[model samples]
Target: MSLNVLAVDDSRTMRDMLNLALSSAGFTAHLAEDGLHGLEVLSEIEPDVIITDINMPRMDGFGFIEALRSDDRWSRIPILVLTTESADELKAKARSAGATGWIVKPFDPAKLVKALQMVAG
Candidate 1:
């Protein structure tokens, strides 16, 4: 079966880029403008993997993870945080919030595909 991926970011450009990349990698991509929208999308489409940015307008990545973890239905979904925040503290926080993995911004597309493969599988 093809993998289904949900990409959540406030930036339209980022969402588009992720959509393109994941599609090229042979996965179906679903885009969300922010964390709230991501959650809404999740409720409808049970994606195999989720990738999100940290800084968003309504409900940031941390809050999104908290909400995901709080719900038993969504708690097992793998989440890979892809953000510009390179701070160690932020990485730790993401880990604490239930992120399956992390990818820093300006990431290589090949590496991103590899990461997605690792998480989504």
Candidate 2:
């Protein structure tokens, strides 16, 4: 099955890279600039998996995850944190916020695809 993925990041280059990686893996990718933009896009599509960055304007990843977890429509979806931050405390915080997994930045495309399949397929 082709997984519908939502990638929320403030970087245009990161968004472009994710789009390429997902497309190459035969998955549908939806791009969002930040947490707020992600929420807006969430209204339009039901994603199988979500990949988000930690730092952003308007709303951060933690806030985004919390918001999603609070909504019945999105609570069960898997959320993966893709960020440059590698602090253990931050990971714990993200976990508490309802993240399903964590992946450090400069991600491997193959691994990301595998993770998405494992979690969403």
Candidate 3:
């Protein structure tokens, strides 16, 4: 089955790039502008994996993960955090909030595909 993925970021460019990259890597991708929008999109599309940015308007990545984890239906969904923040503290926070893994920003498409494969597999 084709993997369904949700790419959540405040930047339109980032969302578009992720969508293109994931689609090229054989996954169907859905784009969301921010955490709040991501939640709304998730309600409509049951994605196999979620890739999100840390900083966003309305709601951030942490809020997104917390919300997801609180929901029984979405708690076990694999989450791959894609962010520019490389601080260990932030990584720990993400882990505590239930992110499955993380990928630093400016990540290569191939590396992202590998990470996604590892998480979604």
Candidate 4:
């Protein structure tokens, strides 16, 4: 089955890159500017997985994950944080907020695809 993905990031370039990677790997990709936008997009699409950046203007990844986890309708969806930060504390925070996995920024296209498939499966 072709998995549907929601990619949330403030960076237009990052969103574009994610779109290219996900589409090339045979997944349908949806884009959102930030956490709030991600939530809005989430309501419209039943994404198999979600990929979000850590740092953002409106709402950060931690807030997004927390918000998503609070809702039973989307709590079980796999969320993978894509960011430049590799700090342990941030990862712990994300985990506590309900993230399924994490990927450092400048992500490898192949690895990103693999990570999504592994979690979404």
TM-score of 3: 0.97
Model 2 bad stretches (over 4 Å): none
Clashing pairs for predicted structure model 2, backbone only: none
Please name the candidate that would achieve the greatest lDDT relative to the true structure: 2
Ranking by TM-score: 2, 4, 3, 1
11-117: candidate 2 lDDT, tens digit per residue: 99999999999999999999999999999999999999999999999999999999999999999999999999999999999999999999999999999999999
Cα distance off (Å), candidate 2, residue 67: 0.3
Q: Candidates' lDDT values, in order?
A: 0.90, 0.97, 0.93, 0.95
The local lDDT score (0 to 100) that residue 6 gets in candidate 3 is 92
* lDDT at position 17, candidate 4: 97
lDDT of 1 at 9: 94
Those runs of model 3 whose alpha carbons end farther than 4 Å from true positions after fitting are none
- Residue 115 in model 3: lDDT: 82
Which tens-of-lDDT digit does each residue in 14-113 have in candidate 1?
A: 8878888888888899999989999999888988889999999979999999899999988998999999998999999999999999998877878988
| Predicted structure 3: lDDT | 0.93
- After superposing candidate 4 on the true structure, give the runs of residues whose Cα lies further than 4 Å from its correct spot: none
